[model samples]
Target: MTPLTVEVTSSTGSDHLLPSKDPWYTAPADFEASIPGTVLRIRTVPGQPTVFSNAAAAYHILYRTTGSRYQPTWAVTSLVIPKKPCVHSGYNALLSYQMAYNTPTIDRGPSYRIFEPPLPNNYGIPPGHQQFDIMLDRGWFVTIPDFEGPRAAFGASVQAGHATLDGIRAVLSLAGHPDIPLPSSADKFKYAMWGYSGGSIASEKAAELQVQYAPELARGFVGAALGGLVSNVGSLYTVTNKTPYMGNLVLILLGVMNEYPEVDTYLRSRLKTEGPQNATAFLKGRDMDSFQAFQTYAGQDIFEYFVGGEADLEACQALRKIKMVEWMLGYHGAPEVPLFVYKAIEDELTPIADTDAHMEHYKRFNVSVLYERNTVGGHISEIVNGQDRAIKWLASVFDSSYDKEGGIKTRDVTVDIYKPPIP
Candidate 1:
């Protein structure tokens, strides 16, 4: 077995090497500002969803965040500050809400959803993410990150982790505006994370990567609430491929390919003409829904389009070399920050068994965690319906007064099986 000649691109240095002309990927004037987890550019977000729209102020933020290569790259996050102080307890406080903006188009980020409120004919902004509006109404400043990074690596952990954590840092660094006077320092804001499904991936990665990637944030982090967790990509690949949901997985793969040229190169060699045709359709910035994509390519087996069929790519050693699987694989280590993991019993994308595996792994360690198992709905249902419970748990974590009797709250993990009313 001679050493495989690994073909890698020089663009691996900084995602900036081959500019895609995306503003988020574009580096700042000061290269030093491009330091991992720092602010690159600051600007006021347009079309502020009216003051009556449950949020006080809206701003778009572009910050320097790390990607999969652990290199300097930039990403964007949307900041929504509440009108009043947090009624719960101390510090102005912050909440990083990861929106499940699952799409191949780079511009279809959470930032666009919040600001682009409904006009006469603009129905593009679905209530899919309005779920976080209650957090803003709670008097907690919320920062929604494009954790998928510049390349929009949806399922890539390191990139999501770096971008997620850096979004928080960027928001904290913002100079105080009169509407919402932010804490001058980090300690002044007690923060927590909340997300479901795709959003949960970013939240969980940020939580796990905090100690290694951003230890400074550990102090400010109170807890993390992740529902509908994505435990494994291998599992994801198994279920979504060539199925209706295959469209969703392909978008994520394109995300990885855009970042890793070698993977793209390998796939290009194996892909038939129809692959590029499908790729063009995906990047069109229109309806990127999986079911919609399913209708379009229903009987047309994508496997047949591959040079040597699906087995060839799966068997390739280079596929495992992508290195992103290391983070996406669950239970890398027990999170130092408090955790709340919940899932719908019959999640469409991530099954409860997967969530159970995660909880069991965390249980191995004596970390205090709040795990909930709801017997209602699928992945999207958990995101929408279980939000109240998730938000309540996060509030308790953020509250300085709410703690175990004079000590850190560490309890044996309790599994609750409640059937939520079907929505």
Candidate 2:
């Protein structure tokens, strides 16, 4: 198939097209015949003044990837080359910055809204773009994969990992593209991964699955930094149910259902059909963003929508399948590269114990891990407070300065002001 390229000088113009309407997102007739990570389509949306303003150039690659069930599929990743040369280690550094766009909505993916106007109160830039700006400012080329795949399987780990690893392959394959400037040789770049919350699901899964799924790219990876991880989906229900994050339960359910038809059939048969809070209503979350889901279903009981409530849902064989496959981390494999993981001790959305168990699982396999547990913040606050540390650790990883000699290292960070007052 011939590659398609569109030039845009402004965010609002005739060339602007949403992912849903864009033909470039469509896979060619024989895409499945190609190997995973094979570039199917390339759309060059040169950096505009308003969108990705910090980037010297940007391109979107539609590449072959595997779906949740290991079926052939395709995904798009947005790649940005920084204006400045690679100053770190005198070699190009590629940071796959996964965005925490937890929705199953394809249009809500970063590549779609990347050139659109920012939502209100977001400082005139789209959400998640700030992270791109920061990475670009550091002279590191960045790639953000729509790792959820064509179906937008939010909670499916295999699909996320495959798309991410394959996205890197797709990017590396573009080293000699005449239009976009990249190192002539792929080995000239050091790669790293960073993601938080929903994004962590992809980054962590990719790290664990790399050795087996994409062994060729494994040696190029320096490390991965994950924060506010959702290690166990089954365990998360207890913490988020009926809370402000209760809506996430719906999103996960719908997301998993998208990948596993059996789960969808099982859920459809058991969900309450009548009333405003029925299964049909919640399933609409497939098109809603994370914020919309939170606002629409906040403080609502998820079990109440089921025919047999929590008990019947627990007995579901379909749920069990995903619980073991897509919902849980470390079941597939362990990371070949070192890891820097951070989490809030009192995170409201995800349990810290889950991350602790996850880290131990990696440690059992001799995976280098540096775990930091912050005593003072919740899930949201830590994203800001831990930003500096995560970026610093990533920088160290890229520059070959991070220490990885010892076994798993754990640190407990407690601010003096957040400590309990003496009686």
Candidate 3:
């Protein structure tokens, strides 16, 4: 077998170490390590002092191999809590994850460090909470996978899922680490996952793949929670294409299109004249920096040049070629364990009907699915506000007895109208 290689890329190289200027909690003594024939830590996002009520430490993982012309590149990392219970059947470790999205920051970019702390208002553990310290207090370890595989492996949801699952395996498989306690190799360990919006997309895919891709990990994934998930790309394109939302819509589309070649050709036919070569460049070029402004530059109004005066048939037919939603319906749900799923009632980015349809599908598989609708927050709010509920649910998964706390719920769903079609 080819040996795996690992290294602490962040502490060395051109990586910039952000100061531990957190407002909520102090970070544990930080250090990076790597092992050969495995993975490496490329960058570290330091824990905060006391800003948000609950915060977690995050890490980025990179796959490394020896003698390869292309050096091992940055992969994924997670907010890690040292000294938590190891809970997998074969492995004894816990790693909470942050999902990937097209926005590029937390989405598919390099991993950000997280400082696990307290819930803002949900837990009432006081305003200034330290997640890392508290997890240690509770005898649980926490880590967040960057989920952006090597090279920020963008837009490939399955790849992101596999990477997160592998990251947990790698972390739990570690020989000795100060933050985590050692369980006799004989002890069956456990694990849990939580993510929202783009993060949820990655988490959902991860849960679905854990059983087949990593059967050894089958027994450990006890529970998972995802909110505001992007479960259907075809549906998303149908509603958001050519509208202002289409800009943000295109990034994910392009990413997925890149991952699945048939979709790429479909997009090329609909949007690329002579190979929408520019599409790939544009996708990685713009992060969430100006998502609201992309329509002006490349959306339908400007893209009409390539559509060849036809829109519906070719575009819709081409989209069907990908089968992203049909694929979603086929996904295996949260590993025969307790599951939690929430969707914003007024989500602007993801369609509620799609989310509903997806939940109904999961029911067929007898998967424990909890789909909540938030009455208050919008798309971005789901990302920010959903963290509290996400973490609390994750805590419960890590320790089954910790489920007494109340989680915020949502029900009212509404759809935003699209402006006149651009083409």
Which number leads on TM-score? Answer: 2
Look at candidate 1 and give me any clashing residue pairs.
Answer: none
Which regions of candidate 3 deviate over 4 angstroms? 1-10, 13-60, 64-74, 82-93, 100-108, 112-140, 151-154, 175-189, 242-244, 261-305, 309-321, 325-335, 402-423
Ranking by lDDT: 2, 1, 3
Better candidate by lDDT, 1 or 2? 2
lDDT, candidate 2, equals 0.82
Q: What local distance difference test score does each model get?
A: 0.64, 0.82, 0.50
Best of the two (2, 3) by TM-score = 2
The true-structure Cα RMSD of candidate 3 reads 9.5
lDDT tens per residue, model 3, 128-166: 134344544444555555565433434556666666676
Q: Which candidate should be chosen as best, given lDDT against the real structure?
A: 2
TM-scores, in order shown?
Answer: 0.81, 0.92, 0.65
**TM accuracy, model 2:** 0.92
Q: Whole-model lDDT for model 3 versus the true structure?
A: 0.50
Q: Report the lDDT tens digits of candidate 1 across residue range 1-423.
A: 100111111122212211144343465576444456566555455545463356766666677787777777788887776777574544776889887666555656666645554322121222543565677767888888878766667657678877888888877665343333466556678888887777787788788888787888777788888878777655666555565556565656566666667777777676655754444543442334343454554444455646677775675565675534533444445677877777767766666676676666666665567767766666655655566778888888777644522212323222333344433
CA RMSD for every model?
A: 9.0, 4.2, 9.5
Against the true structure, candidate 1 has what lDDT? 0.64
